[model samples]
Target: MAKSGPNYKVNGKEYYRVSLEIGRDATGKRKTKFFTGKTKKEANQKKQEYINKQILGLKDTKTLWFAQTFNSWLFEVVKMSDIKPTTFARYEGLYRNYINDSPLACISIDKIEPMSIQRYYNDLFKKQKKSSSQISYLNKFIRKFFNYCVDCGYIVNNPCSGNKISLPKEKRSEAIAKKVEIFTDDELNKMLNSDDCKIKYISLFSLATGMRRGEVIALKESDIDIKHNEIHIRRTIATTAIFDENNIKTKQTIVQEPKTKNSIRDIPLPNSLKSIIKKAKLIRNEEKFKAGESYSTKNLDYLFLSERGNFINAGNLDKTWAKFLKNIDIPHKKFHTLRHTYATKQFENDIPLKTVSTLLGHGDIGITADIYTHVLKKQKEKSVDILEII
Candidate 1:
């Protein structure tokens, strides 16, 4: 008698087998193939191999365009890969902005060659004048998509492989020559003394702690240990687009863990900053009282709240920073410049690199050294001046 189901005994030996439909034969008869192995896992693997071989042998795969294949890859492969929401949103944004309607996207997947991708990148840099960084991001997405295609037998090889593409030389050099920007001492002093209470407090807090904008806004009263003179960096507020079942996108602000374990560290709270924290608390209490029942109860422990009594929006923070700079008669700098300024000041004050790195919550001390190389060079100059005094 023949064995039943997936498990069977063939000549008194155990075996696992699976039957899969390959296609429909001529005259509409169903064609099937059996894959057998010692174990069910092995049998499944054999079945997948056969399916992949059949897909590779199909001539109709040449009809699959890049746009269609990209959508299929995104929903079927990328979406199921367990990436962060922010990262997925970024990938979606890159496809929409750079790849969706481009000429390259209209070509058949199998027809996409190295030079075809190279030309697309060249046009982005030369004709569109898009930055090298932007093109690099687009290239990364395209390369990953093509790699998936190759793995799934849609293509024989990835055109992006083997270093066949590169950015223009001048654009590459431009990106390499970019320098880290930071606020000057005078600018920092001006910002700390701003008449705008919100700006003054947040600026002082950021300058004092060297916290990222997201980390600062995500801070809660509970994270502060006044007796210990320590402030804990726990979480961050990120704004990312969330996609629903139907692929509809909505922007949302979410509190998430810090980017890395090193990002969650404790730093000593300066005595001067203590007074500012106290004042901020008093202001929040006053606002809560005035708003009464209307005050937002969500995340009430948050150290900073907008006028509407909700968590501060990252976009609104940036706009406020820009307006504050303009009002103070200072040249506009990114909010991140405050962080750089703090690190620079530390290096200038002869603080050890390791100590500075830990305070900044850098995962590696080398990262701290590289970013503040200019400051370290200046410190070296000061050391030479001391030698002269000796």
Candidate 2:
């Protein structure tokens, strides 16, 4: 490269010399040049400085792959976290079906962009036509995946940002009716003296204390407090079963504990009902002994037991309840209606809301009050009588 002579320009009566120099590329492969302020000295300084800095190896992007980045990111962020088995199964299913085993899953992180994510969502909707909620869930997982890529420097930024779809609301179920199934005193007497001792005890205890079917079945001998005249609601017997993909049985059984913490509570039992439970306990022990087993050998502590002395399932309890109602000729009602009936009866007898709330084991008095608004409306109607008398 050649050095050109300084070119001078006069301005404000002072001469300025602008100079230029040309040099080889800093990589030393190509010829390069520099230009500077009105001096040959400055031009040479800039050219030499540029060449020195380049020789020190300051460079730009070399390699970027989407799939490699995504895979690396997956191993880095998601592999160790504790996620629900069901949730992991679903997410992994999506990955296997659509992304993980596919070509797009391998796209370079730097090359991944919003258009790519938008296209993925479009393809999912086009191919599977998933429900709004399903699409929303898939979109969320993809967004999270890309967010991880961004955090790990695999990608400069998340492509799925600002993409969101709202799911439709699910319809609410109608509330159960609150009609009081007030049996005639004679019917009540007959029911109390029913020959089917198991049904009779269950009916008496349910009606007396207003415990739910699950609460009734989950009762353990130890949970009963004879001195305090109370039944402790510790666990509930609801059945969930594992199944093969063909729906063939893997295993089936009962789970203890009611669905909510509020379901565990203390319910005051009627004296008459307590006597029945005490007698029932003795009968259960005698039956166990007859079967060459000890009552102490009973695995579960539930108050109710099957022939095998295990906690009863809901289906079995329902069948027994239906049979008892039919044999007694009482109005047919769902088993849970017994709980409503109990609460309604308490309200009819003018029990305080707080007391009823506690009896139902409601976490909030407002919830107990809300569920029984129909009963409360009646109470308000009765209040008119007080207004008239006053």
Judge candidate 2 at residue 337 and give its lDDT: 65
lDDT of each: 0.83, 0.64
Span of 10 residues, lowest total lDDT, candidate 1: 168-177
Candidate 1 residue-wise lDDT at 242:
83
- How well does model 2 score by local distance difference test? 0.64
lDDT of 2 by residue, 1-390 (tens): 886665554453323343334455668765534345456677666555545535654221124455454444444445446543234445656665666755466665555666666666666666656544566676687778777756644445566676433333223332335334455556667676677567677767777887777677767778888889777888766654433434243333465556557878888867877678877776676667776653445464555677667666667777888889888787766777666777888998899999999888788899888788878888878775666777
Model 1 spans > 4 angstroms off: 1-60, 169-177, 352-358, 361-373, 380-390
Q: How well is each residue in 145-188 modelled by candidate 1, as lDDT tens digits?
A: 98877777677788998788876545545644566798877887
List the lowest-lDDT window of 10 residues for candidate 2.
Answer: 165-174
Candidate number with greatest TM-score: 1
In candidate 2, how many Å is residue 15 off?
62
Estimated TM-score per prediction? 0.77, 0.53
Candidate 2 Cα outliers beyond 4 Å, as residue runs: 1-190, 242-251, 293-296, 384-387
